[model samples]
Target: MNVMAKAEKKISSAFIYFFGSFGGILFGYDIGVMTGALPFLQADWHLENAASLVGWITSAVMFGAIFGGALAGQLSDKFGRRKMILMSAIVFMVFSVLSGVSPDMGEASAYYLIIVRMLLGLAVGAASALVPAYMSEMAPAKARGRLSGLNQTMIVSGMLLSYVVDFLLKDLPGEWAWRLMLGLAAVPALILFLGVLRLPESPRFLLRKGDEAQARKVLSYIRKNPAEIDQELASIKETAKEERQANQKTSWSTLFSGKYRYLVIAGVGVAAFQQFQGANAIFYYIPLIVQKATGQAASSNLMWPIVQGVILVVGSLVYMWIADKFNRRTLLMVGGAVMGLSFILPVVINWMMPNMNPMTIVVFLCIYVAFYSFTWAPLTWVLVGEIFPLAIRGRASGLASSFNWIGSWLVGLIFPIMTASMPQEAVFAIFGIICILGVIFVKTCVPETRGHTLEEIEEQGTNHGRVKANNPEN
Candidate 1:
């Protein structure tokens, strides 16, 4: 009631938001830092062992990410988001130090890099899943989109840091410079580990496990006050009661028992295409592409990534603003369109080079970033997390996340081959087609989850004319 107390509460809430969001930074850092380190690794390690050696080296992290993402869904569902993330942070710290100190390419066993990348991918995958899960649970109902949107911001910012490190260390010996750049990630990993260690358990996770007391403990901080807590708990219980009822009948066959099948397919499919749309094509290979484009030295390529990081960060920031103003479905639709169109920019730039103005192509690239960061990047995670039922959420998110990582690994595994085997036109064309398909998928299947409680989201999908979340005890 007092001015200072009110201000203190506001500051406390802001701090929670900041700390909650720091997980995203780790996710972003893990994704981007590899680029800066890869060139050094090739030279230090005998990546020449196979004709596809470079591809194996690069795809190794994604391969690990595949398993990591799958592990996150099941683990987070059972262990709680905060705890799972802390465990992930430990992985990050260990890998960060080991990756940096890995013996030079000649002396270091090729398997060493593969093993470390796989381990790091586990950390990245866990952080990616848990950060969104935590943000979705803690954010105010009205601000969920924006709050979850922070994950995108943190990811891009983390990526920006990698670029900055890459730029600063560009001139250093790749082996030495890459090590330091990567090892620096340990700092954020430690911070996430310590900070989340002090955080409360997710109220929803608690409720899912029937721990009302601890749920209330977390809700007490997240809600405005005791009255607000009461109001929230009432909704949670109502929604949870529905989930509890749903669990009575939920089974392995539940995914296809009725209307729920379409949802499962659509949800997982959309999440999968987020990568198929070739977003990672840019994220993972931009450095190498940029190095080729400007005739810049390897280190200078990082500056282009900083440009990309800026575009990605700014676009995602806009999602926080627009996620509320417009229809969630509409944002997704328009974003897909823009992204689909933008895919042609690269092909066009490659076309117009040596003859036409390149600025137009440059502008398109930024616009492409703008469209994706604002739309699919944040919205996909929000929808996936909110769209499934609690009984199946664990299985659903696990299954869906695995789908996502599989797509990610597909890109990682095939992109190098694609680059080596195909022309640039073919790569951009593949992504453009995938984006078009994503737009169709969204329009046809996914629901608009705006203003719905977690309970309501589950109710939207029904089985045999009965609410899936309200099945009678059998």
Candidate 2:
């Protein structure tokens, strides 16, 4: 490529990466904003004593996401990933405003906010499923890990941005403060919508739809070498043809039978474990946990999220560096081990020294978040995006995303109640156990996908029982 042509291609590639993953900002902001807003929301709605009600409001988006993810997955299969993402951005923008302006109806307003946030959750869920698949499809296999992992980078960056926004708006009147925190999500949604307009559709999707010409065009922009573009297109064609012949009608049944069953289990297991590890519990309730632990006001501890957010962002950056270089299974195992230890040690410390400093728990939680940001958090999406067959990628990813949201919903809803009923350390210990289980799951089920093409991964899935025999890495 000539110097000027190379520059233009670089700019185009940069824009694709930014806009394709931009939906993470919307997803991250919605999930993280409530971390700061909930304290004020509880006071405004007189939910001080109603832990269940508070939990419901906090988890409502994740509840709605379950349906949203499943539906978007099926729809994206039919309509194309780019179009579904565009639609999601629009939903995000509209519902974020509605959530902010929810009518005051005493406790009923909480339900109103719940309904609105659930609608917004559709977008969040769709983005979670779509960004990874889209990035994986658009990326060259050699660069796929780093490119797919960018989705997590954007996710943590969005979270950090939300934390900063929450802190800046903390001094506003409670009603306005929370309202603006919820409402400001619309700005990133708008940016995503605009950016999606300029993005090329995934080449794999285009080829599957029998638009080889357009697929070639998209590959041209994303893959600079002509030989590489032709090679990838040929591989996609071969895989799509085999998938069509093997299963003329792809459905949920397809995912549960034959070669696909193992892939789905592996993908969905990783997705679900990512949340079941209790990262969201910490992310969503950091300030509240601090309040309960120290008797300090939750509002005054808003800065804690900023601290956690910074750790998350820094960790994500580190993950991006190592994403393509390390084995996925190794990263997950190592991260889960450290993360579980972070949680377990806190409980051990509290037992040994009953009068330990309150900030000690917060410090451990920060360590948990740091390890999580680098490992399971990003690798879940990377593996999910890489492991599925081409014809079923959309639905499989969506299924995985829904499972992920289901785990998030359960943890977010139950964490506060568990903390209220038991010692916080005990609740965290449960999560620690779950993390240990996660490491075992990765060892036994999840295959390493580092440096492998999607086509190669699918071939390994086809030879299911031989995967461990052939690779010795599974």
- Tens digits of per-residue lDDT for model 1 on 1-474? 477445433435556667777877877886787677766666556453342666666667677777777687777777888788888889989988887777754544566867887888888877766777677788766778777787778888898888788778877876787788878999998988777756777788898788897787677677767987777777778877876665566555766656477567766877898888878767777766555444455545667778888888888878888876776678888898888888765676667674644344445656777788888888877777666766667556666766777777778667767766776555766788789889898877776767666666666665423222212221
lDDT of 1: 0.73
Kindly list the per-residue Cα lDDT of model 2 for residues 1-474, writing each as its tens digit: 477545544548889988888888887887799999999988888898898988989999998888888889999999999999999999988999998898998878988988888888888999999999999988888888888888998998899999999999999999999999999999999989888887888888888899998788778888779999888888889988887786668889988878788888999999999999999998899999999889999999999999988998898889989887788888899999999998899889988999999888888888899899999989998988889988789999999999999999999999989988999999999999999999999989887788778998888887753255224244
CA RMSD per model (angstroms)? 5.1, 2.8
**How close is every model to the real structure, measured as TM-score?**
0.88, 0.96
Task: Check candidate 2 and list the clashing pairs.
Answer: none
Error of 1 at 378 (Å): 1.3
Stretches off by above 4 angstroms in model 1 are: 1-11, 46-51, 105-108, 225-228, 243-259, 294-296, 345-363, 463-474
lDDT of each: 0.73, 0.88
Worst 10-residue stretch by lDDT in candidate 1? Answer: 465-474
